[model samples]
Target: MTPHQAEQVSFDNTELDKFAAYRSDGATPDAPDILDLSNNELMLPPLPAVAESLHRSGLRVNLYPDPAARFLKANLARHFGAEPAETVVGPGSGGVLQQLLLVLAGRGDEVLYAWPGFDAYPLLVAVTGATGVPVPLTATGEHDLPELLGRVTSRTRAVILCSPHNPTGRRIPRDTLREFLAALPPRVAAIVDQAYMEFDEEEDPHDLGLIREYPNVVLLRTFSKAYGLAGLRVGYAFASAEIALRARKTVIPFSVTHSGEQAAVTSLAQGEELARRLAHVRRLRADLHADLGAQGLTPIPSSANFVWLPLGGESDRFAEAALRAGVLVRSYSGDGVRISVGTEEAHRRVLIAAKEFLSV
Candidate 1:
């Protein structure tokens, strides 16, 4: 084909417009007076030991990271009590999730997940050339398991379940999840998105026995939220050896940076420090929930480090009010607004704006 033909091919723009680009709160401009709680990022600095590890790793910028992130994989295997072959590491949970989808799904396949959950799910599934089938959450903002299972067909490649679900903040109880898994078809893989599992202080976050029970399960996790390593972007997953191997084959080489890998390794060693941060986040979440309730708003109780208000048509209005108060929060259009558990000043600002909005 001639160069002119190649340029003309780009003119079609058919597949290019299949979906919208993935947007994130990280794009919000940083300002001295602004408190951006739009993104569910830990507002605290990195832990002492984690900070030191990153500092040392920074000195070797001239070298390339381990393409497969062998050390990080080994550490994760030990931390989560799995064999190295059972692990898949990538730049972030989203990145790792994409890796899994690239292997498990493709053109003509359908991936099912809850709507008003992760904004990126459909976009991520689209990248694999698969259609994203959204199962709407219940009126109470919880997943309807039977409804989801009923949507599955012979072409269904995977079903994603997010516990401590995003934006809505409701978690799937272990027994409930186990029951769902039991009913799911054997050929279909179940990807359990556990990005916020660390903030779930009331349950056993370290449990890996679920994978043993369901070999098709893929537990996706990240160092972003509670570990304060969002900037570094280290994520991993635990799956059966066969599934993990396929996911690993899809990993983008060197996507996990050296500094990110080391920081994750160091963070894994500080269980006590991690616990302290988790407890602090839980306190902030509860306080924020109660405070919002006091303002006559119904904020869903969260197992994650954020509170979700199902404002219906007021979602955008409430988010606008928060921005006017110099606090940025996420608005899911007519669904709700998600306010990350930020510092005291941020929450204070949110409360004032909320009360002001209610009074009007």
Candidate 2:
């Protein structure tokens, strides 16, 4: 008898084919020497204490990390004024988001979020076997709360809101966000992705009032952007104990390494240093925005560590020009470009590119 043919592999081929890898701003193939402003990372080194923690943890690399990440969770809880049971830690905020999606959504359920927001939202939602629905941002790059509310249906399982939204750096006002949450159905979870929260100096980064008032609301934070811990891959979330527990269950064992936990905990203790870093970032962001404006390029008013240039069809061209000028920025094809705040020298190079590109 002829050997039976292998059965076709089971997979979501369509979704897998459509998926694009997350692109971060860094040394590009054409311009390895370019100053990287593609990723919205703090252009600074880690805190002295954090670095020391990393050094100390080097000797412990041979040991397995705490699978529950108890110490990191406790530190985050203490820093954010939440109970340890109400927090979850993971490899990064992106990882924590994946955990939440897996716990709260599944096949046939729908996850809604603003388009051109965090690039990972759709990918993460898709991995959970949920349908990803994207609503467009307003012309000014702010969330259209009414539009998002109108799109919610019975099948909608979760909504991801990004403050100081990525690629645009526009924040949803506190009152506006509160109203949006109030209008959302309690059954549908609201995930407030506050990855850039610390950069908004005007806001109390540790405030958990929203989660307290609305048990369905979850806050996502990361040490990647503000803490200069991108390489460490530490992120966390705060939610109602029920949701937090469920999400925690989805975490892969020991995904957060020992070094990340120690570094993050140490960084949390450097409140004054964090404040100084925030002030410097805010100042640099302002200078970059103003300088771009002087070059006749209208960048969106940013409340985060990056600025958005609504270059529309010219986005790619501008990015190319910046690359040629020795600076790397993130371009969204026909939409716009996001330039992270960098050193004065890097900003000068970007400005040179901006002036040349506009004059052409």
Candidate 3:
């Protein structure tokens, strides 16, 4: 075969194109109009102070960002009580995940993660030429530990755990995570992706205590969620100093820009105010859950900023109606619809749209 033919053949089987294929079709305008709920981004930008800082810090456009992303890493460490040396920041949580996968797993290896979890997990595994072992959640929509434990093999190099899992919004309890970590072979690393931890009111959040005990455990977080910095694209991971240092080395230098780093640090510094804003989102999420239930739509109990509506037969239809209503909600044909909790007015608009769909 000619070189061109081989290149064409290689592109055809590229697994990174999973969701990449779905990106072409943009959301319809008539949809829910509630794009505000996307990954915890507020319709409004940060407060004036943050905005002004961005404005004045102008045109460092000529210079590259700090290679280590020191300021953002320091702020995240201070905010989360992690050791500064144990933290590393990336362009976003997705970037951090990609870095982790690249560093830990390679071709012929196995990666264990929960199913109906993050859409990116399986795709990333496939791109790496690694086997993606997806253990489905239980009926209640919680990650099933026994089944996951059963899937582990000597080839399993790592496990990815997302608490307050995307799509489902069900968090893996701390004790459960500890148990899973303990059961895994010492050679295998467990990556805890806490993208929605800020929305969780759980008394004892997913334990970072394990990091001190297990050199293989890594905690991943993102400013994209509660910090309302999704557009700025900053995320981080915490692990033992050794693992964190290794992960940092794999990161492309200056992957995070100047604005992204500053925004993340500013967001962390606005802690109390940010917490209040997150609480509002939680309240709205609760209200949306109740409103949808009243509309005869069964929604999964959400601990995140978004709620899941299990539209067994009409998932697509309902999503279509939402789009028609000028609101944008995520729809998975075989799964359910994940709606972000927007402002109160926006939430009411979505409820109206959802009600109309249910009536039909």
Candidate 4:
């Protein structure tokens, strides 16, 4: 008799295969000295207060963290002027988003997001057993809200909007976003991913009136980008109490480590430090933009901590040149490249690479 063949595994294998793991072209060992402008990480070290908190929390690593992340959640709630029940904390914004997707969508459900947006959006949506519907961004790297609104179907359970959109760094204007949210069907949830909101030119980053105005809107934020806690991996979301409760239930217990919680809470209290850091990053971004423009590369105006070069078919070439110049920048193959604002030295290397590439 023939050896028994194992039965085929169940679930959507095709869908899983179609999705790719999130990729970031960060520095490699071969280029140990390379200036990494690939990942949009804060170029500066963690805040002094946050560092102190981390050191204190490090001593308690043996103990399990609060599963509910109560302290962090409470701080986040107070910061946003929302009740504790309205906030859900997770390992990072990506982790929080995953929980949200699990709670709001499932097999045969559709999740809509802009293309060339956050690299993780599609992957997370796929993991939830939901179909990921991507709407292409406009030529100027702005979300085509009309196209997005038009694509909505009855099966569309959630829409993910990235302000100061990843890669492109284009923000949807407040009025435009308000109109879009108002027009969206009340049954469909809207997730505004604001990981880079702090870097935006807005005076008040902690404002949460949008949630009150639109019950279906959920705001996602991360300490990784602005707070320089990428290593600790802390993020949170604010939404209606009902939605937050569901999302909170889906979070993996103790996913937000004790150190992360303590650090994030401490970081939240350092508003002046945060403002200074934001101002510095904005200055660097502006300088980088001017340098790129002077080199004849018209990078899109960015409110976030990175710049987008819509190289179209030549994106890989520019990335390659940057790498050769000992600078690591993110490339989207045929679409564009995103270079994070880094130190003056890193920006100098990027500028040299840009000049060389443009000349060729």
Candidate 5:
């Protein structure tokens, strides 16, 4: 094509036109008194030790971060009982996922995931020039694994499963996941996104030996959730050496900052603090679930830091009610509402909204 034709054609049908950009609660403005629980971020601040480490690392602004982020990879591998060669660190789990998608898929390839899952999945797949196939969630808000499997085709390059799934908060049982992986064609990669894994008490995230049986499995995680390091944007994954090597090649050079890396390393060592935070979050999550239940809203039992109300068409209405009551919540229109567990006061505000919503 001629230069003018190329420019016109590209402008007329931009790659971005195929998908919607991700929008998070953090990006929108909030009122001063609003108790924002829409983002599902940890309510607690960083551990004191982690903060101190980040402070010390901040002085190295002029120097670039380790392109390989070897320090973080080593610590993460040690903490999880994996080898450094199997670890892939990136700006965040999403970034790590991008790296994986870049290496694993491209035009004519299909990457499948549950619909109403992480909003970023489609955008990320589109960036890789791959088609994103979304399987609708069961009416009960859980993954329909059989349906997902049926959608797989020869062109399918990957399947992403988000445990303690976003929005719905439903976690796939370990045995069930193993079965799914076993049934999946080995040629297709299985990405298990455990971003909220730390918030779960039933499943041990350290079951790091999963990659042994399934060479195609990639266990992805992020420090942004339970670690309260959302701003730092540190995330990593454990995979076979072959997958890790290719994913690392796709990493944006020096994307992982020095401060972020050190904070992650320091955070891993703060077991006591981490445990305490988890306990507190679990308490808050339980209370929020109960309070919402008492208000006549059936909140699905959540394994993450948030609770989901499968309100269907009432979703937007519920979110608006929460906003009016000085609380922020995420509403997946025509689907449900996901409200993060927050301070008792923020939660109380949520309960008030729930009560009002129910009475209406």
Candidate 6:
């Protein structure tokens, strides 16, 4: 075998395959092309105000950005009711997560989290040379807080809690979260990844209140979803001032581009517009679930902007069928296909394709 082939064998082959496969082949209509639900990016672009700010910033090619991202952090803190020193902005929340893994984990350290959750947690922990301990979720696709708490050990450095979780789209309720945190070991860091919190229909979807009381809890938020700033890649984290400092050290200065920061800050000031967009997506997601049910495909209840269809290997078949009908959806084998709640047109296309797939 070639050296390159040997290197490829060292990683999770499933991830390698998923990463390598494109939803569509440019020249072929046989490949999926109509809808892209694979990467979880919001279908809409940022508001004109945000777009205008980026356009006016021009090229800051020669200057180093504010190393501490003070102004941007301050704006975010003010919006979230947190202190400026308690928050740190990163190019994207994913990048921030990478930094957290680097700083808090090392060889022989075990990182605890729930499985069928974010695909990145284990991958990131492994990259940092730490062991990953995944506590399985309940049958309803909810994180089992008791199981997770039981697995925490002296060697466990951190845990990642993904609410409005990926793939499954179920959320961990506030009362459940409080119980879990109360049970967690003080030394173990708990990272709350609220990537899809904006789309949550539930009241009080976040746990910012816990940050005020638990120095160990770090809350992660991003602009990629409801804010529609995915292209600019902006996100931030909030923790106790001391923990925030350690997390900040993992990322180098100017890592967050000036344009991205400006766009995010502008979006924050734009206010209720984002909440309006999320409400629309939430409504559409519910409508799509009913549509899928009408066609005999069970779509798991979702709190995020997408729905999960439980179909194992048939997920690949479902995705292929979707492509045949000129629509694309995200595939998860151990569970099913995840269709993004996009335009009304896209949602209708998925419904038609799903009906056709089920009939056959």
Q: Which of the two, 1 or 6, has more lDDT?
A: 1
User: lDDT of candidate 4?
Assistant: 0.90
RMSD of each: 2.0, 1.7, 2.9, 1.7, 2.1, 4.7
lDDT digits (tens) for residues 12-52 of candidate 5? 32344776567733335366888788888988877999989
TM-score of each: 0.96, 0.96, 0.90, 0.96, 0.96, 0.88
lDDT of 3 by residue, 146-234 (tens): 88888889899998888888878898887777888888888998998889888989933335687888899988888787877777788
Candidate 6 residue spans exceeding 4 A from truth: 1-33, 203-207
Lowest lDDT block of 10, candidate 2: 23-32
> Model 6, range 180-200, lDDT digits (tens) per residue?
888888899999998888788
- Model-by-model lDDT, in order? 0.90, 0.90, 0.78, 0.90, 0.90, 0.80
Candidate scoring better on TM-score of 1 and 4: 4
Q: Give the TM-score comparing model 1 with the true structure, all chains together.
A: 0.96
User: What is the lDDT for 113 in model 5?
Assistant: 97
lDDT of 2 by residue, 287-337 (tens): 999999998989999888999999889999999999889988888888899
Separately for all candidates shown, the number of backbone clashes (residues 3 or more apart, or on different chains) is: 0, 1, 11, 0, 0, 0
How many times do residue backbones clash in model 6?
A: 0
Error of 6 at 111 (Å): 0.8
Superposed Cα deviation of residue 355, candidate 4 (Å): 1.2
Clashes of 4: 0
